[model samples]
Target chain A: MVDPEIRVVTIDDLGILRSVQEDPATGRVVVTITPTYTGCPAMDVIRADIRRALVATGHPDAEVRTVHKPAWSTDWISDAGRAKLAAAGIAPPAPARRDGVVPLTLAVRCPRCGSPETEQISRFGSTACKALWRCRSCAEPFDHVKAL
Target chain B: MNGPFTFALALGDDSLIAAQRLAEWTTRAPEMEEDVALANIALDQLGAARLLLTYAGELEGAGRDEDALAYLRDDREFRNCLLVELPNGDFAVTMAKLLVLAAYQVPLYTALAVCPDERLAAIGAKARKESAYHLDHAMLWVKRLGDGTEESHRRMQAGVDQIWPYVDELFTTWPDAPVDPAVLRPGFDDTVTEVLTTATLTVPQVSWTPAGGRDGVHTEHLSYLLAEMQVLHRAHPGARW
Candidate 1:
């Protein structure tokens, strides 16, 4: 039995690879992915990568489809994902409000220096999903996953 | 309350209206990647509309949520530009339109991120990133198509030919419009021209441009799209998915 937690953490930490499904007919798998943001350049490569991984694991004919509905959110990261994120040296997304209103003090910490003393340089980073951050502790720049 | 909600409607209308047009190419794009790309862009636009409209409904406090406003409104009520509502003629044509509009919107959101209204600013913050990717995606295609084979170049030119007339409507300001175009990003035309030059495509020369979407006067295509989009919501009011 595959541990659901590991899958959760892997997806959460990587911030890609949205959902996986196994086909009962041929025992093949289909993975449903949503890009981190709408215009992610790596999405096509990621889709192909997912297909390759599934095929390498004996699901050669497995089909993968990308879905955009209900949209992916940073809030979907599970506890296991948070742990993986911490271990990966990246800070996890701050908790979300049930009321759907973002709190004012929800500043992201720099992963490299582990300092909350950072500022948002831009809403965009190296990739579409991350925001650029400059750490006060190390004064090094890094990307922080923006809250959805 | 009125200004914020109206501004939100302008944003929402832009996305919802654009998505409707992009959805027309769902199964008809040149290739699979193109299909997915178009659909993904459409979905992103739709999602943007949903977010903005939901916020607008909350601010209005009139018991009209996103669903009610999106589904129940007539064409005249929408505040989108005519450029978004124009039909997708061919791949190059669609890409040309995308290049123009996305070029306009990327800077528009970049500046809007600093808006005094926190919600608008926050939404703009998120949208700025999304629209950048969108603009890049479309711009990449514009370059590929423009510099490709002779047949490809012809189609690309033809695409521009068909879409050139509609471009002027995007920057026009209407006195009674929901969002003032003057308050939008300046030099929109210049930015579009720069993008065209970068793509190795010449900007089409046109004298007359169509404009009328803000007041709900849309081409006949819009009614058909609305009919298809709102059927489920209209038939079963208050339906949730």
Candidate 2:
């Protein structure tokens, strides 16, 4: 049987795995997920993917549930996901600041050239979860997953 | 309606109306990037509207879902402020309206995040983050247009003036609400002032204030906006794409 984490990560790019447990009697796996953002359209896709992956991997009766408690933060993205995002030329979000002060400027390092000198082109990027940025060093435009 | 139900409907209507106005800019924005940006913002608002309306339906103990509340209700049944229902006059005007509305939403959601209602608090926590981005986007535009060329600056100022009269309506509140809108005014003012100052613009001094959207009294623009938004859904009646 494939590991549940690998199966779930195949679909959840945000790395929002909260919990996975098997029912002792039914032997059915129940996966719990927390969304990256409340209005993220990717959520439906993620849910469908999880169900498909689990069902295809011999767990035909697996259940996926979404929870809202302890609201999702960018800090939840796994280290592996962060590396994957950078390898894909997308800057992973910085750790969320506990202090409520929102920084006027986010110093996102360019994933293309690993340069700290990056400027934000648009707050709303190609997707709701990212911000468009330009690397001053590489002169290439990229997306930075926003720190929500 | 109960307190939570009414409050949820008001929030849902605000997002729904704002989303409709933003959708009007899909292919009409001055820049292609703005076309995508406005559409994204509109989708965000639509998503929020769906959540709030769905909750409202559950609170009301009615069989009605988000669609019934959104498409079946008459203009008079909506509880959104008049500011959201106003026409998208131009890019400058749209930015001006967005500046005020987004600024208002930031503090409003922040306060609601800790409200007594657990479900509302959860929604508020997520919404607070989204609204911050919306406010930031509006601030950047307001600064660019307000401090740009002479014509752009003048138009930006005029946009502010046109929308200023309706700003007061956003601060109106009722008892037992999750957050007192009046308490959010100071934060809203400070944020707006900082942005306006950076943009080299002044707050407009308006003498007349419009109010009463919470009581179903809205500007004439809302009826037209609703007619256009609801026509398809009303015609089909439970048709799903």
Candidate 3:
């Protein structure tokens, strides 16, 4: 199912959907997901959507387990998902910064004009998953999926 | 006090209270983006609180769940440090509080990430990443406001001084904790000092070491905060959205 927020990216494409184990014999299914953020409000909706999808596929007994051992990272977003996000006017995240270094962002190319002349408007946006940015080239405001 | 249950409860209470305090900034922050930022940080704290409280309840082996532990408890039952329970004084004060809270949490969670407790470790492994972000955000604001202008610098310093006395309570010894609170002090000091120095703010020097939140002795502010927070649940028990 597509992400309830972004709408253009599927759960698989976003990689929050960790694994799905299904038993054809008993029609039993177990799905595991790691939340993009520990406080992500989307998890409940995503779980419900997964259950609905499973029921539609004839897997009536399904277990959706949430795990946190291996934390979620923006790097998990697939390349195709990035493409879909850019196509939808939302800038995909930059490479996940490592070693806890405060990333010095040199540039964020405007999704609309592909020019590196974009400025961050705020460190936060409409949702926890993205930041607000303004494109200098196109003079358009956009959301950038923040790198965590 | 030695039980892991109380240890987890204390940690949970810290996050829960912090979340509630941050959430108070919703619709009231100085700017629209700040409103969203505080709300999101509040959500993160709430998220971590839920996991810790759930684990604490399980460890207690009592009938209490996260909601029961959270909603049914009164101020005296809460284990959050006074720093979190204090009223949001001003924008600078709020940022100062966030700076210290996130500074402490990052090291605490990072230490928890490698601790022997599997569940806490999992929670920590996930939470440390988020705490790092929170810490970064707070540092940015602290430095900006601390060094910005004459009035801004004065207010930021005052904010740090106002919140400083309560800071010592967070690092008191907890022998049964996954990572003893004392052990986390050095890291916390390092992080806070650097940010404060860069921000042109002093790390307030205070002789008063008021403590005892672990044993559920909180300040008067907690009672009022809990009255507002737990009122809905107490009025309509077990109500859900």
Report the lDDT tens digits of candidate 2 across residue range A1-148.
1223223233344657788899999999999987766667767777877788798889988999987667778777778778877887888888776533345566899998899998988767777777788999989999888887
Q: Where does model 2 exceed 4 Å of error?
A: A1-13, A23-29, A57-62, A99-101
Between the candidate structures 1 and 3, which one is better when assessed by DockQ?
A: 3
Off by over 4 Å in 3: A23-27
lDDT of 1 by residue, B77-172 (tens): 887877787778777878888987787777666666666766666666656656765776676777788778888878887887788887667666
Q: Which ten residues in a row are the worst by lDDT in model 1 chain A? A: A1-10
List-wise, what DockQ does each model earn? 0.05, 0.46, 0.71
Q: Which pairs of residues collide in candidate 3?
A: none
Model 2: residue B235 alpha-carbon error in angstroms: 2.4
Model 3 DockQ reads 0.71
Query: In candidate 2 chain B, where is summed lDDT lowest over 10 consecutive residues?
Result: B124-133
Error of 3 at B108 (Å): 0.8
Q: Which candidate has the highest TM-score of all?
A: 3
Residue-level error in angstroms, candidate 1, position A65 = 30
Where does the lowest 10-residue lDDT sum fall in candidate 1 chain B?
B174-183
Better of 1 and 2 by TM-score: 2
Better of 2 and 3 by TM-score: 3
Once fitted onto the true fold, the runs of candidate 1 whose alpha carbons sit more than 4 angstroms away are A1-6, A10-148, B174-180, B183-187
Query: How do the candidates rank by lDDT, highest first?
Result: 3, 2, 1
